[model samples]
Target: MALFTNIARIQDGLLLCSDSDEEADYTKYQNYAKQLFQKLEAMEQKIDKFSIEESEFTYHYYIANGVCYLGFFKKNYPYRAVFAYLKELEEEFRRIYNQQEIEEANRSFTFIKFESVIRNLRQKYTDDSSLADKNIQQLSENLTDVQRIITKNIKEVLERGEKLETLNLASSKLSNESKVYAIKARNFKWRMWWKTYSPLIIIAAIVFLVLFIKFFIW
Candidate 1:
């Protein structure tokens, strides 16, 4: 059975930190949500909806009115229900709070009151009987396959960090190798110059010594 783990509201990439009783780690989920928000921001065109899949949970996010509503659900959770929940949350949030208040709030979980709202919604959506509910059934019917849309595996996400670390290490090693090669080439050039010119230098010294002795003796 898929569970509703968490919900959040983000604006302009900043999470409106709110107090929550949900079992999922808020800090970790917040970081994941921020990464998703950044990906959306990077796109030239705005995307109103997207999903990211992690090992334990899949995230469904909705963007509206400059605020992002993010939800964490079990992998098999119905995405349509998840989205409908987000939409309801978004609408309710907008109804209760103005844009200026949402934007100006700097404290974490500033909207702690919403936690109860989420709990209530989660119960309604997660219940088996809710599947037969007209609203949920309609939502499920209207939506496309959640698995097919913009899904990212948790392993791939972790591997990306590992790959970046590997690239940095490789780059540092290559830079050090180049520096060592340059120093060796300079030393080799000096040694070759010494070998090529030593005899000529010795001959010149001998010739000068002979010229001095002859001038003095004569």
Candidate 2:
């Protein structure tokens, strides 16, 4: 059985809708998904599909057209099935909402009404054993490419301590002036090294040329 599923905007990690996983104490997994949102937001190029493996569960997420569909499922659950579910959810979401609606929304879970659809789809894929088997087969025969998608350990990913765009966004803030200054300082150091040593290098080259001409040519 699935634990949780949600849809969010990749641009800013806004919660558009989340499935209701009743009676499941999946707050920890939900937090992982939220962290991924923040991590994915500043990425210039996002992963189209990926999974994070945890102890008891694995998180599957897919991105398309600036939207992200994420799900947390049992560790034994088929990755192909999970990705297929996400793709279907993404398609249905696109059918109901356009890019403008997704972008212009100000509040979290603005499309709470869409939660029903999410729950229905999750049930359709998870509850029925036969359907899940068939879907996994279809995914294997098609271009799901779940095998090639990147999968990272959740603990290692969290321990990496946000070495992301803008150089460790978590160490300070989003627009961390420190990193910017660090880059500038590096560039300046290289320029100063050249400025100071360039004269010595030129003099050495001239002396070598003169010595060579005096000895060999003259």
The candidate scoring highest on lDDT is 2
Tens-place lDDT digits, model 1, residues 1-218: 22443333444465563333455555676566566554444331345566677776776666676677777766665554555566667777788788888778776567777767767755644553233355434544543422243335744654464221111111223223324433433454566678889999999999999999999877
Write model 2 residue lDDT over 1-218, tens digit each, in one string: 35788888888888888875788678877887887787776563534665667886777667788887888888766554565567678889999999999989889989999988887887766544343355444433543322342335675676785433422212112113223322433455566678889999999999999999999999
> Clashing residue pairs in candidate 2, if any?
none
| Candidate 1: worst-modelled 10 consecutive residues by lDDT | 163-172
| Candidate 1: Cα lDDT at 185 | 35
Highest-scoring model, TM-score: 2
lDDT of 2 at 155: 54
Tell me each candidate's TM-score: 0.55, 0.64
The alpha-carbon root-mean-square deviation between model 1 and the true structure, to one decimal in Å, is 26.8
lDDT values for all models: 0.55, 0.67
